[model samples]
Each structure stands twice: as C-alpha cells, then as structure tokens.
Target: MRRRRSSGTRREGRGAPASRRQGRRRGGTDRALCGAGTRGDTPWPVDYRRSATAFLLAAALAGGAARGEGVRDPVADAVSTVSPERLAAHVARLAGFGTRHALSAGSGEGRGIDAAEAWVAARFAEIPGVEVERRRVRAFRLSGGARRVAAGWPVSSPAARFLFGLAGMGFGYREPAMSNVIARLPGREPERLILLSAHLDSRPGKRFDWRTDAPGANDDGSGVAGLLEAARALAPLPRRASVWFVAFNGEELGLLGSRQLAREIERAGLRVEAMLNLDTIGGTTTARDLPADPALPPPGTLLRVFSEGRPQHRWLDPSPRRRLAAGPSEADSPSRQLARYVRAAARRYVPDLQVELIARADRIRRGGDHFPFLRRGVAAVRFTEQREDYAHEHQDPHVENGRRYGDLPEFVDPEYMAKVTRIAVATAALLARAPRAPEEVRIDTSHLGETTTVRWRPSADPEIASYRLLARRTASPDWEIERDAGTAGEVTVALPRDDWWFAVQAVAKDGTPSLPSLAWPSDR
Candidate 1:
C-alpha cells in the first residue's frame, strides 16, 4: 500500500541500544556450551532441564555459528548473488505490460493480469526444485457501481464516462477470476513455511480505467521482482524450512488474493513461520507534493518495515481496551518480533541500508497483502521503500504542469531495489536454515521474587545446539540482552519479572538463531 504521507512517528535506525554489541551477555551463566548439570545449584532454584535423547542427537551435528570470522557462509554467498541489473529488468518487463489491473482483460500474449500471472509462474518453473501453482480466487462483486464497467456498459457521453471513472475509484470492480501465483521451494521440513510475497496488480489514477497504461513499476513491480530474485538465489541452497515465493493478485482491491491464501493456509493446517511482504520497494524519491522528512536518512539509504504493535485479533477480546491498558505487550507481538528480526538481519547483511521500524500495521488508513496473514495469527511484516512518490503511484503516465507522473520504471532505483532484495534474501535464508523456535515458552510469575524463571519445550530439530534467553526492559522496543541457556529447557535470570519482557530462541549448532518465541506469563 502506498500513502501520500507518513502519519506515525518513525523509530529510526536498528534494534535496541545494547544489541549493537554482539555475543555479549549479562547476569546469566553460559551453561549452553557446558553439559547439563555441570553447574552447581544456585541461591534460587534453577532447573537446567534437557531431554537426554535430544541432547545426544544435537551433539552429532556440526557445531558453532554458521558464519564465523574465517568460515564461508552459504547464506551470505546466496545473498551476494542478488543482482541490480536483473531486478531492474524485471521491473521493466512488468511495466511493459501496459496495465496489470486485477480486472484487466487479455491473456496468453503476455499482457494484462493473466499474462503477468503466467509470466510469474513460468519464471518460477524455470528454477530447479521449485514447484509452481496458480490458486484461483472466487469471484466477488465490486461496490459503488463498479460492476457497470465490468459489465461493459455503454458510455457514449462524456458525463457517463466521468461517472464510470468515479465509480472505479470507489472500491473495486467485479473480478470473475483471479489467481495468486505461488512457487514453493520444499525443504527438509515442508510443513514449516517461510513466505515472501508481492502483489501483481496495478491501477491508474482513475482506479477503474482498465484500458489506461498504469505501468506500476515502482509501486509493486519492484516487489515482485525482488521476490523472483530472492527465489532464484535461495532455490539452489539447502534449507531446513520451506520457502514460498508468492505474487498475490487484487492487492489494490483490498487484499483479496492474500485473504484467499490465508484462508487456504488455515484450512490446510499449514504453519507459516514467517511472511515478508514487499510493496513499493524500489522508489528512492519522495512524492512531488510532500517534502521529505529532514530527520530521516536519505531516500535510497533507508527502508521501512511495518508490523502490528499488538496482535491482529486483539479486537476479539471482550474488553480489549481494558486488557491493553493493563498489559505491557504492545511492542512484543509476533509480528513485531518478526520486524525486529528483519532489522537485525539487515544490520548484519545489508550494511548499506538502514531499516527503520514503523511500529504500525501499515501506513495510516492504508493496508497491504500482509494484513490478511497477520489476521490469521501469522508472523508477517512488510518491506517498503523509505519514501514513496505519490505522483507515480495510482497515476497515469503523462506530463502534467511540467511534472512527469506515473509509476514508471525510470523512477525506480536499481541499486536500492538490490539492497532491499538482499535484506529479504539474508533474513529468509537464515530463518530457513535455523531450527524451529522453541515451543511453549513461558515465564513463571507465581512467586514474588527478584529473579525470573523462563522455560520452554526443547525443539525437536536435531540441529538445535542450544537456546538463548532474550530479555528487554518493559519500556524498550527491542531485546536488550541475550543469555546462552545451552540445551537446557529452562533458566533462572537475576532480573525482575515485572520490569522486563523475555523470549527464547533455539540456536542451531552452526550458530543460526531461529525466530524468538516470546515467553507468556504462566502460574505453573
């Protein structure tokens, strides 16, 4: 989704203040490297619990962080292969289609929505070990007389044409058939999925004008291009979890395609570990009318990641406002955790681009394809360009008052697109290779003590070498400290439970860390 101006206050730069110093720990024993029961009993009861069978299995795997000072990282190598030229070419090709409007006509000739869908499917099919599918979306009616245009109503008069165009801008028109293009790269654990998505549809200033040329190059062509490039880079690598490269349709029409996919995921009982949606990721310039924020980093040097501040379904709570007022978990939602993960990954891999965290579901009053997955309780986040040129988005290609308008390919920065692509590649690759997050993570809040007890069920993945207990101040936006809890399923930290938020992540023997699972308060 593209917005004319940013509404919320932006939190600039990467993660918590203390996260800059890597491999550092405070107030915790490094029992993760040592065998269980090696440490003596402490003042507070500490249960260094571990399953004997799981520990024995982990010991047989390769040890240490995946990428060390001298070691070559396959993940990093794949990330380095992201090409600016290839990404730009994709944007150009998609733009050449004239219009990719969700309800646009024509197919088999590489034009309109069907052609875009076919092109995306064919590209994924070319990559070895990748399976492609076009999942059909049910036909739905468009409101505000948009069905008139869909029904081919005669508009002989200029007044009638104007009325029809106005109707197009209302909501959306009837789409008899639309499909989301999905390309799956199966891994050792096919059920555990990581998704990368972008919308494949575009619209002109006259939202209902299907015949007009709305290239949509930077708005989302760049995103689809990035999805393809990430797939190409990660396809040849060995992954622990599966990755799905999806090009969603009807995003401009209220996220219809994503909503369908989310329903399918729930119906099939598929677990989406993480979902990254790229939208308008190629623009490097601010909108013509809106001045750039002086406090923000230069356009091409930064990117924004938007995630929900609280659970998407929090409205389901009977007393949501009261519950939120009493809780300190506003910044600790699953989607927020995923956003932090992306920022951390960018810091480690995409040094050239600074990822700014927008602690909101999306731009004010605007939505994207990620919202549907987020509503389904998936850890989803969006990646968009630091600044969007509104004149280009939803505008037709024309010169008006000496200004060039429309989302044209020439306005997209290839270098910037490459950097954004790298962030996705690095994050997805690392996550795909890491062990699944520890399950049933909980913090014991029964006793009134200064120290906190964190526990979780050991990950069944044989690659898990240890677990890291992460904690941050209640007021902090990101994790501030990490303690190596080893293979032990539980740890006692010398910190006040009421003053901090805690999470646990399983670390692979090769040093890859899985997504952190927040510790829920429990009386047990």
Candidate 2:
C-alpha cells in the first residue's frame, strides 16, 4: 500500500575553496578532483585521518588498504549473538500472562500488565551494563466522549481526580495510570542517544477486552521479545552514544507511553541520533498465515521498515510550512535515511534477513511509537513483519470455523523473531558508534552540465576521518555508486546534476559510516 508524497524545502550555502585530498572518485579516480587542492591543509570543517587502530584493522582485513571503508564488521559479530532460543523464551513468558491490557492489574505482581512489565524490566536488569527503571504514565479511557490526552498522574491529575470522583455521577472515566519500563546503557557520549522501543500492552478483540485471553504473541509480544534479545546482545558492546531499550505500556490505548517519553527526551534536550521501533515482527506469512510470496525468500528473509521522507515537524511548525513549498521528500527524510541505513547494515551483518523499506510512516492509518519521536524531528523508523497475520492480532483466543483466531505463541516463529531482533541490534550498534552525518550539505547547480559538485560542512564530531559520496539515478531504490572522498567536504561526481541524486556521509575513525545526508541544490 503506497501513499501520496508530500514535499518541503530547506536552504544551504554554496562552496568556497578550502583544503582537499586525493581520494577515489565515482567512475574513476581524478587526481585533479574539483574538491581537492592540497593535502594537510585545514578547511573550515576540520578534517582528520583514520585512527591507527582503524587503519590496522582495515589493513588486517583488506591486505593493507589505508582505509578500507567496508572493513567495519563488529556489527556482524553482534548479530551472531542474538539467540533464537532466548528470544522464544521471552515470547513464551509474555504469553503466559494471558492478557496484558493496559487496564489489567498493574500492581507489579503476577500475570497481567504489571507482571508483563516486570518481566521485561527484569530481563533488561539482568544485562550487566543496563540500568533499568519504570516510568509512570497515565492511560485514558476513550469510550464515551472522553478527551484523548495523557494525564500522566499515577492516580488521575487533580482535574482528572475530580472527574473520577464524579465518574458514577455521570462523567467519563480514565483508566488508572501505568508505567513504561526503560533500560539504559550509558556510553562515552551521554548526549547522543539511540533507542530501541516496543510496547507491552495487548488488546483482545477490536476493543479493549481486559478479561479475555489476548496473548499478543505476534501483535507485539514478538516485538517486545526482539527488544529484549537486542538488549541482551548489545549490553556489553561498546557504544559512543547511549543505547536505550524501552518497553512501553498503553500502546494499544493510543501510543501514550511513547508520546510521553518523546516529550521527556525533548524536554531534557537530549540529541536522539536515531530511534528503531520493533512493533510487529513475527508473522512470516499474510493475514491468513498461509505461504508467503513465492518470489521472495522463505520466512525470516524479508522485513518491513516504515518511515516518512518528510519531517513531521514541518507540518507542525508554522515557519517551515509557510516558507518551504518545493516537494515532499517522500523518500529522503532523516527517518527515511535511517531506514536506508538499517537496510545497508542488515545487508552487511544479517545478510540472510532482507529489509524491505515501506517508505511510509506505517500501514494506512495505523501508527507506532516512532511517530512521537518523528514529530519532535528525531530520525525514527518502525520495523514490522513482512506481512501481518490478522487472525493472530487483536483477536480473542478461540477457534472460529475451525481456524485459530488469537495472537498465540504457536503462531510466532522463534528463529524469524531472532533475525528481526538482530537487524535492530546491528543498526542500533552501527548508528551509536558512528559519527553524525554531515550538515548543510548542498549540490551546486549554478550551471547545467554533465558533472555535479556536492559540498557539505563536516560533522561536529571530531572523530570523522573522511567522507563518502553516493550517487544513484533519480528512480533507483538504493545508492548504486560510492566514492571514498578522503577528508574532503566536497566531491565532484561525473554524473550529470540532473540525471541522479547525490549525498554525502561521514566516516568515523573506526570506519563506520553515518547515515548519508541528501545533497539538495541551493536554488531548489
């Protein structure tokens, strides 16, 4: 299902002469590259070379190449640690709760929402380097004419308290507040954050049926399991940016937990480098659980990553909305770039699991935890199963016309779930360790010609040792060509400015590449 594309515009500066280096160019090497002038000369954007350790590792892997950009493979090592048995165990335990509805007993004791929350929190706590905590948040009752908003109080707010006091007297009531479980692994850089999130609450039937059995083994129990697996696999991994594994509550109630979390991150002024959401990633087939598409590989081979090319803030903020009227970057927003990064990382680390970029916020009107962060201008994306089995989602445990009809452990494929979890781990680890993408990147189109010169300001991160230039035809799904433009902020590609899209990425000293920043022409 595809949606219409919306576009917006932003401005950037033109290039000025500065330091340059002789590096690989697209099509072929050009010693007189347009960007390169002299070596060791400092440009406004500080340039550095690959670290000794990175050079050693790249040489060890690439037969003495000074900087083999493709030599970063710690992600593959981390991906291998995701255990299918452990992942299955998480789903099995979550299903044991019978139901995890937001309104279910949250006393933090046994077999319900509280129990499920405690189970997830306990799993994160067991990881050696993780700091686990639970955050209290309000859950609303939207039945009747109740207003949809986050009350946030354990009991209701003062106004909500009064409303609850008058509940039987004739006003709509709200559910008791619930808590979201958070596990953090602080990194060397505390200000930078990469989050892996999933919701724990479940709903039976079309509406909230607290007493009924809604195992949610596939709906999001699979997602929560994936989060736990990733946390366990990544807990000991060294990250430059902090990594958070969050299990949210009240998702079925309208993404309440995530909404509050995003607000808090914004209020705290933390820079979220990227957020990866695992929502529904267990189903291996379509709505009826039949065979998957024959053209595609077997189960666990394909996953859907949904993202928006346009920043949600553009629609919310008046200034950008009024001034930028170009075209919606339907396939090139920060979140979309993060989506592309996930695909690239998965291809390199978890090669067996293919990522299918959905190129939309979510499926139709459906949404996930990523939306809240996206609204705050954070790059975020959602991971879901290639095809969802409707019979195993939001349905009560029962047999209708001789077919099973509830989200159950029987429907989830443990190995498939583990592969999905590994994808999240790989992407998160790569993003957390890499430097930030270049800023204010622009393409020069002062004259229409066969070649295009792209320029950008270097990342604030001093660890960035070099930059990579990427180009693809206007209609291509992936970047088809890559050039190692060593420490140069600008590069001239042989491709015509009008024939292809171009972008630049920063390469950290460790050889990890940041998500590429699309190079848009200034006049556009």
Which segments of model 2 are wrong by more than 4 Å? 1-11, 17-72, 106-109, 140-157, 160-177, 284-300, 311-328, 447-449
Q: TM-score winner among the candidates? A: 2
Any runs in candidate 1 off by more than 4 Å, and if so which? 1-69, 140-177, 285-290, 311-328
**TM-score of each candidate structure, all chains considered together:** 0.81, 0.82
lDDT of each: 0.74, 0.71
- On residues 329-421, what C-alpha lDDT tens digit does candidate 1 reach at each position? 778777788888887777667878888889887887788988777655677889999888788889989999998889999889899899999
Q: Which ten residues in a row have the lowest lDDT in candidate 1?
A: 4-13
* RMSD to the hidden true structure, all candidates: 9.7, 7.0
Per residue, candidate 2 scores C-alpha lDDT tens digits across 368-460 of 887777666667889998777777888888888988788888888887888888889878887887777788787765556666777787655
- Model 1, position 270, has a per-residue lDDT of 81
Clashing pairs in 2: 6-328, 7-327, 7-328, 8-327
Residue-level error in angstroms, candidate 2, position 439:
0.8
